[model samples]
Target: MEHLAYFDCPTGVAGDMCLGALVDAGLPVDVLHQQLSGLPSEVRFTLAVQPVQRQGQRATQVLVHPQGEQPHHRHWAEIRTWLAEAHLPPAVQNWSQGIFQRLAQTEGRVHGMPPEQVGFHEVGAVDAIVDIVGTCIGLHYFNITKIYCSPLPLGSGTVKTAHGIMAVPTPAVLQLCQQRQVPIYDNGIDRELVTPTGAAIVTTLAQGFGRPPALKLERVGWGAGGRELPLANILRLWLGSPPASALTEPVVLLETQVDDMSPQGLAYACERLREGGALDVWIQAITMKKGRQGVLLQVLCHPELVAPCEELLLQETTTLGVRRQWQERRLLPRRLVTVMTDWGEVAVKVAEYTGRRVNVQPEYEDCARIARTHGLPWKQVHQQVLHRFWQDMGQES
Candidate 1:
């Protein structure tokens, strides 16, 4: 299975902190420097590799320094123009612009101005810019096609910044985080932990947030924050093959025989079971103890939700008792990938086995759309999509 890059943010991540960690993870700092070589005199930086601890674990953190005078606030248009024309790689520039765009929107709301009308306050500073741009370049070097982040720990309380002591989680940070499912916690570190720029970069670049998946472990890197604390100054990185696509888990299958239940009655029971969290519930035809035909009610669900759903089975089905037990099954990791179809953009589900692409099928929504537009049978559209995908892959090969 192909691997993925996972960021473990025990301590909150900052733009500089993330960039520093990527550097520690072996990004080409010298190559990154060469691209930013001739920037205006307002920006200067120092990069160093050092060891730090997080909780009780020791890891390396990259420290960045933007000494001397900082730059003045500029409008989004001006900043974006320079970024667009910069000599940086396309991926780096794209990532940086995305982060900045997120911050600009947040600032716009805080200051009661349009995003373009908002000025870059502390974030516009030369050092912050360098930190973000450097991080973008570093990620490009890794050729990270996809990234997933752990839930962010947005610190609590207010901290002093160029914009005054507004709040611990600044307006910009709060605004950016509100739209995402990233988790926030307050551990009494009443300081500014999740910066707006950092939030932008991490969330924009990462596809989703969750714990590490099944993967073959490879190289791991830790980026450290330059702060000296009782705890460690480190950000952990895990580079490995994603966990096995099919995970082995125990599931309970419930069965009950019904000889006198109406189809509607059976449906009601199944619906209730589903509401109670049965994985699947349906009827199967079978011969009963009296040699009479009957419908077999079956439910497959997690062991935990089985009891609650079982009550529904007893109440709705004609059967006096239900048989239940456990079964082992392998579940695949599933995600929907959007493909550009001749009709338009259609969603297709990609199923993987140990990180290898094993199946790709068009989504019902897409199949229906194609059916309506071309006035063809829905099944035909679906079949065509499935057929075309493999053909396209063959052409690519």
Candidate 2:
């Protein structure tokens, strides 16, 4: 059972809002306090969550109150070191570091400085650190396997920062959105909606954007923002598991046509795509404009791999743009079993439907390896493995 969290950011998201939503969804606030206490930071703070109302909607507001003088600024190097030295769980540490790293890189790009040389202003504050780390801890606590988010609503007007007043969807937020090609829209609110911390957290962690995926929703949590707007100023989080009986899962299909690249280059691109997590890669000969012969390269991959797969096509092939679309694919339940043959052990793949075996075949690569070592025909080895698997199954039954 794969558990997922969908961030329905109709208004927007912030680090504190995310923490609030996670806690509202049943993550104990004490868990965050216990885990985040492991961070090696001098600035002491405590997390507090209270039931709040955002434009008449009930939600949770998580606050990080610093207990003492906090650092005015923190450089990327300092934050990285703290995360590395922390005694927190590896997942939490890694996730928190990743979010902060994205923030640093975006700020660096906006300020025309190298990422290592970039120093965080508002994001480097003790509260932001706790917000980021606490969010990761909450996700880890719930065992969230994947994260999906909606198109972020970019607010209007301006916002104040340690760098002084900046435009809404501030420079760091805009840079982060552009990096991932994240979808955004103007929400027509005369204030800052998406904060830099919020943009960094979601852009770094979310696997896909748009509508939520198919899930058997178990719980809903609303995290309220500070300001009250015409609508609910909350980040709604949906927690659930993928349906057990559903055989179809979502995928992305990437297609591009390249007439100039060599056949060898095309083959290499396909190899790279497969290595990069493409479920399937194939090419079809086609005639393009000007009667030039071309091959349409197509890649089927999980939605999360869309960015990398599209990148591979553009970099590895002679194509200007790649087309992508969401798709559903039906899959059969399958398992692997090893069978002992005369030469060695070979793996067989068995596919089942409705509790009955519908298809069974020897793993081609394994059979081929055994055949090469034994100096036997590959076909003979394959047959022997299949025979041995059924024989073993009969004995077991």
Q: Which candidate is the best by TM-score?
A: 2
Model 2 lDDT, full chain set: 0.86
Candidate 1 structure quality by residue, lDDT tens digits, 1-397? 3446777877677777777677777776678678766344446777666666666676666555667765557678777887877777787788888888877887888889899898886778776788788877776676666576776778777677777777768777777666554556665565566777778877677755556544566667777766654446556776665446564444668998888878888888888888888888878799988698889889997644555767788887778898877565566878776666667777888787866787777899778978998899998878777777777653431
Write down the worst ten-residue block by lDDT for model 2. 242-251
What local lDDT does model 2 show for residue 264? 90
Q: Can you write out model 2's per-residue Cα lDDT over 1-397, one digit (the tens) per residue?
A: 5789999998988998999999999998777788988988685887678999988789999988887888869899999999999989999999999998988888888989899999988888998999899999989998998998888988888777887888887888888887776768877777788899999999999886777877889999889898899878999999998765444566778999889999999989999999999999999999999999999999999766777898898899989999988666767778888888888777888877766787898889998888788798999988878788888884451
Candidate 2, residue 63: the lDDT equals: 89
TM-score, predicted candidate 2 vs. hidden true structure: 0.88
TM-score of each: 0.62, 0.88
Candidate 2: regions farther than 4 A off: 187-190, 246-250, 290-292, 302-308, 328-333, 352-359, 375-377, 394-397
Displacement of the residue 289 alpha carbon in candidate 1, Å: 36
Off by over 4 Å in 1: 1-3, 38-44, 52-58, 67-69, 243-397
